[model samples]
Target chain A: MVPSPVMLKPALDAIGKAIDQRFDKLLAVPDDSRARLYEAMRHAVIGGGKRMRPLLVVAACDLFHVERDRALRVALAIECIHCYSLIHDDLPCMDDDDMRRGKPTVHKAFDEATAVLAGDCLHDIAFEILADPATHEDPFARLELVTELAVQSGPAGMAGGQMMDLVAGDVTYDLAGITRLQQLKTGALIQWCLEAGAIMGRASEGQRKALRAYARDLGLAFQIADDLLDVEGTSAKTGKAVQKDAAAGKATFVSLLGLERARAQANALIDQAIGHLSGHGPEADLLRAIARFAVERDN
Target chain B: MVPSPVMLKPALDAIGKAIDQRFDKLLAVPDDSRARLYEAMRHAVIGGGKRMRPLLVVAACDLFHVERDRALRVALAIECIHCYSLIHDDLPCMDDDDMRRGKPTVHKAFDEATAVLAGDCLHDIAFEILADPATHEDPFARLELVTELAVQSGPAGMAGGQMMDLVAGDVTYDLAGITRLQQLKTGALIQWCLEAGAIMGRASEGQRKALRAYARDLGLAFQIADDLLDVEGTSAKTGKAVQKDAAAGKATFVSLLGLERARAQANALIDQAIGHLSGHGPEADLLRAIARFAVERDN
Candidate 1:
């Protein structure tokens, strides 16, 4: 059963605080010229966003009773990828975003060069954290994490997705084209979050398959919801510009399917996602709530 | 003793072809919208600059008789990092150079957004290559390679060094400051190339130490030679802008020490680097030759 927002709030709050504290510790500014790079990274990452990705990681890990600390480290690595993408996407050359998460973007705050390095540095740190023995006692597991993260976030994944988005205005994308784009851009990483937990927990193949199925549907639901937010969300509520896809004439789910169908599709996907977790019991409630929250979130 | 230029030439050519061929295969363009991103990556990486870092990885691996295929994979990974840095560094928001390796920079050939994504994609691919089982049969060795590469190329290493370089014009750096800056920026990855070989070969502690010492001196000498090239060589020879440091009024080894002193210092470092390999016999010739080549090459 899907839990209410009130029930899900605690998990989200905990993950947010955990991620913030970890980043604060990880990005302690050095007393050197590189301080600006660190500060720019911190500014872009700290005290921002809904922490949805980390929340998914933590909730997935909880399913197999994985250690919280281990889960948090993996969560941080994934968040680093997510945060780096946001910083790069917000660059003037990309989306030219001025504000992100209700504050001046990294380039606006620390110049273009620093923003670029900050994003690059974050990308490096993601692998560094995963490869460290502290992240996982098993080298095989660490290698798996590194390999998966790289594949999902690299050319065949998120970057490729962004490439499609960049050319979206020039190219007319049908539903299938947009679906492929979103799967690579957003679905890949979200899917990795679930797979990462399974990897860490050493889940059975059947369990892994179920999680993959759940992740696939949930990722689409998440993107459809994001498209909806772009159409209907407020900058104040979303903490960034809204209606950008429409303004740019990009083909998104909402743009293609119309608002009513898009909203219904998102809800249907969330239900399908929750249905994939039928084998799990109370432990999977957080996942169900998160799937619900995917469409419900304003940002 | 250092081998002759003719002796090194064959090895250089082999590595260059190998790296180019590997990149060509790895980046086979997708039959989709993402083709531009892959094309930009190929444009930046294939048939490009001196494969110095890859040579080092192969040479060091030669010391312990690591498989040629394994050594080449590590070499490719290091080259990816090097190429990605060049692409990002040439961005308009960064160093803003139009040329790299005598060709239009990635950002010049492709648009700015594609360049950024290409660089990022290459960065991700580097770790992906290292973590793959094909790179190493042993997970421990693969993890070690990933950890070292990440640490050396991340915030405290290459990226940090680049950050200092971005602020070089603003800061009046003394000789010591420039040394530290160069160590992080160029030295880190160069050092990683050697260490990667050691990890892959499972070299003993003593062997690793000797290689580290050799790498340290060689990396500095290489940077010093680069500074000398910038001051003395033309864009036609170096395949990049010449006298950029001087034009920007940024302090470099050549700018601080003048031509004669800088050239003398580079020779001395190369000698020191070669001395570190004294314990090895002719198996070390390629490394010794690389040291000599570091200070002697015009570009």
Candidate 2:
């Protein structure tokens, strides 16, 4: 049932192409006074990364037999939301981050005002893209995707998780607290990626539930690996500061449980993620590869 | 046609009560760890403002003989969006104001980070409320409301207009540019209020267009009067810093057209808004009253 990595690559490439086109279109803001806001948004989003979030979305859609083009805009919208979070997280008042993807953060590149507005606009645009009637097939399904996206990204979700991280600080929070933080902060959006794909493709209830399980596990594994990477990575390689979590006295899975246990937790999640896709055929195989890819990733 | 203000008061109060109840239900974060975020959001939204936006929503629904309860959650959601915008606009990075509704701004009441996340949470909650299946007559109509709300509040809408204002500082901009800014910044949401109400009430195409025209003109007129108020009203009475717009070198209707001409423009738009309600029965009377109220209000 393994979707050949070869097949996934072309699909992934197609998604990249679609996302890039939308990014370009968004950047083409009218040359009016508001152009600066669009410019900041473009700078934030167009600065490419692994594009993993969008890939998950498209892959999820693929699982349910959703047309690639049908899921394209939603995929791009997910990436936009992710990029906006990154931009805002890097803001001086937030994480005080200066570098993102080996380049200056939006606030550093533009002014803080533009960066704030850019983040706002990016989040707004994510919903706008999903809600675009010209792109969606079933408007109800599109609304479902948007609802999922908002729940994942907003308060009681990612933003809430961020607040937890900020408050937890150097406090020796419990494992439950750490998991809650990771789930809300990271798992939510990842869950949406899978859910959006399933919804777009009109997957059966069972498939949708299975994909949710897969995404939840995949997200946790991904975050743990991220924590591990921070401890074991180089700034030159990761394009972000290393050991900064400890320096900032921030709570992380690695800091809370040490490298060995964190690795075990992540591997366990990956196993669970793969296990959820047992009956899904080739889609399951591709998802398994993704699960492996997420935790085994060095950066 | 003018709605009896006395009769409208009870309806407006009902809208307010529904909004409070809906928001209270939605913002009940089960996780205690996010206590601060919940607290900040409560402070930002609960017991805030005249609920003018929600009133417009309820009034629009009333005109179509739809129960105000039908649009109650949406009314709350729209007001949340409006409140979030105000919070962000008052931030030092944006308008740098210290007070709103005679109280400290969100950034002042809570930390800027908390304020930012609170606004973020509220914005997301708006869409969440709209997408709730329990709130709508049918999925398609509900999704339509979602799309309308998204576009009206998004980058091409309110946020875009705010971006324009940020970039408009110190620029001797013309009337058209200023009008476009106001339309997007404020008018979009106003238009959405009417359109969403009509859709929820299952109004005919003609009725929808008529209400849309009424709302748009009222929105423009409201903005123009606001500019004039900023120029001539007392800071204590307006609950806003008088002459702040002029001090910031921001482009405004009054600044572009001069005080006398700005007043004239507002009156003209109010008249036009009234015209849109022509041929409608007593149900349309409230719409006219709101239009007149927009330009003639003291504060």
Per-residue alpha-carbon lDDT of candidate 1 for residues B1-299, written as tens digits (9 for 90 to 100) = 46875678899999999999999999999999999999999999999899999999999999999999999999999999999999999999999999999999999999999999999999999999999999999999999999898899998899999999999878889999999999999999999998998898899899899899999898898999999889889889899999888889999998899899999999999889889998899999999888888887877
Please identify model 1 stretches exceeding 4 Å from their true place.
Answer: none
Interface RMSD of each: 0.6, 1.4
lDDT of 1 by residue, A44-124 (tens): 889999888999998999999999999999999999999999999999999999999999999999899999999999999
In model 2, which runs have C-alpha deviations exceeding 4 angstroms? Answer: A1-14, A133-136, B1-11, B29-31
True lDDT of residue B167, candidate 2 = 76
Q: Write the per-residue lDDT of candidate 2 for residues A182-291, one digit (tens) a residue.
A: 89999998989898888887888998898888988888889999999999888877786678778988778998889999999999988888889887776456667777
> What is candidate 2's lDDT per residue for B136-231, written digit by digit as tens?
868777777877877778778998888878777645568888888889999999999999888878989998998899888999999999999999
Docking class of 1: high
- Distance (Å) between predicted and true CA of A21, model 2? 2.2
